[model samples]
Target: MEAAGEPIPLSALQHAVYCLRQAALIHLERLWAENVFTAEGAVLHAVADKGGGRHARGVRRVMSLPLASRRLNLAGVADVVEFPRVGGQETPFPIEYKRGKPKLHRADEVQLCAQGLCLEEMTGAPVPQGALFYAATKRRVVVPFDADLRALTEAAAADLARVLASGETPPPTPLKARCRACSLHDLCRPEAVARPARAWRDRMVAAEVGPR
Candidate 1:
């Protein structure tokens, strides 16, 4: 749980889940770059953000809603939260907007789960499930608020808080897959770190053998 006056951003959880280095760059350094994918995502979020107020079809759709979860130490603006009528009362359901289709990554889920935790804290209600709206597929994927997801969300949040408080940017993992799409590729220069580490090792080995 987060202390009073300390707010955790939902994006932090996603960053921690995806890559610690990315999270550090975004939160610690306040560095950002908009790529093609991110730009499209911004457009989608804008549409949702503009569609304000609650709807009439037993669905109260709130866009860009601010949320915070002290227990998870997470906070952020939810893209949209649909309150469905249940037993004559509206139940909260968080829906997140994504630029791409679902992948083999838990990053999206961690993000949504953090949002759910925030909504639960803010509304004093139990959010059992949420939805992910993907722009590429133009479809909604339902996410169950299971024990595993909740645990992951909380753990990620705690980890993010620790990282942010430390005020240190973590080194990149330099996976080819991450490098290809990461907006911080040029700035991070993962190859540089890897090459230097390898070179240093080589130099140490050479020095050890030369004086014999």
Candidate 2:
């Protein structure tokens, strides 16, 4: 967890889970570039930002809802929040929009959980669950605000705080598929930077030890 009054963007947690260097580049270094994937995501967010509220049946739908959590020191916007009025009671839940499919990492889930945390703070109500709307799948993946996922989300926030406190970009951890998919690949240039640095560090170590 971050020290008091040191809030970071909730999106930074998603970036950190995807790649520490990527998170540092965006949040710490404040650099960004748009690629095909990012552009598509921007387009999706544009639609989400239409800022209209409506009700269907017993459910109230809100778009582009701002959220913040002082406990977690994170803030961001939800794509949609659904308040289902069931049996004269209402349960408010978040739904995030993603342009792509789910990945092996906890990036998307952490983001949604962070929103739930924010909602709980703002509404003073318990948020037991949320959903992720994947454009490719055209489905909602329900995510329970369980202890494990909450811990992961909090840990991600702390990880981001550490990165920001250091004020240094993290070294690139280049995996072929991950780097290839990352929109910031051109800016980060892991292959051009980190691999060569590793080689130089290896050479320095070898020189110091001498041949046995």
Candidate 3:
């Protein structure tokens, strides 16, 4: 729980899940760098970012919907939230735009679930599920806001709030695969920075073993 402060950004929840250090760098250090992948994502969100509402296929589609949850202390703009009639009542169905396909990790799902939580607070309606729309696949992967996912989202929010308030950037956890896709790769320099730290740890271990 944040106790008191600005609401944590919903996107920070994803960053926290993906890598806590990455979240700290962006939220604490205010660092950012764009790359091809991020540009593609921007293109995908161009229209939705404009922010408006419309009715399509009997569903009310709201773009760039601002969402906030006091319970989680999270706030951000949902790319698209469709209010489709469920049991004769309008229910929020958040649709997040992404550049890549479904990932093995649950970072994206956590973000979407946070949006559902915000919607539940704002609309006083149960947000049971949402969707992640991948630009590459051009498909929507439906996500249920089950107990596990909701728990993960809440946990991410708490972790993110803690990191942001700590006022210190977390150490780099270098992963070749994940860092390669990050827009802040150059700024992060995970490999360059983590190598020396890893080497130092190895040296300490060797020293402790005493030539074994």
Q: Who wins the lDDT comparison?
A: 3
Off by over 4 Å in 2: 1-6, 86-88, 200-212
lDDT for 116 (candidate 2):
91
lDDT of 1 by residue, 78-111 (tens): 8899999788877789899899899688889989
RMSD of each: 3.9, 2.8, 2.7
Candidate 3, superposed: residue stretches over 4 Å from native: 1-4, 199-212
By summed lDDT, the worst window of 10 consecutive residues in model 2 runs over 1-10
Relative to the true structure, candidate 3 reaches a TM of 0.90
TM-score of each: 0.87, 0.89, 0.90
Question: Per-residue lDDT tens digits of candidate 3, residues 1-212?
Answer: 23358899899888889888888878888888888887888898998999999999888999999999998888999999999998899999999999878998999999999999999999999999999999889999999999999998898888788777777687798877888888888898898888898899899999999896
State the TM-score for model 1.
0.87
Q: For candidate 3, what is the total of clashing residue pairs?
A: 0
lDDT of each: 0.81, 0.86, 0.90
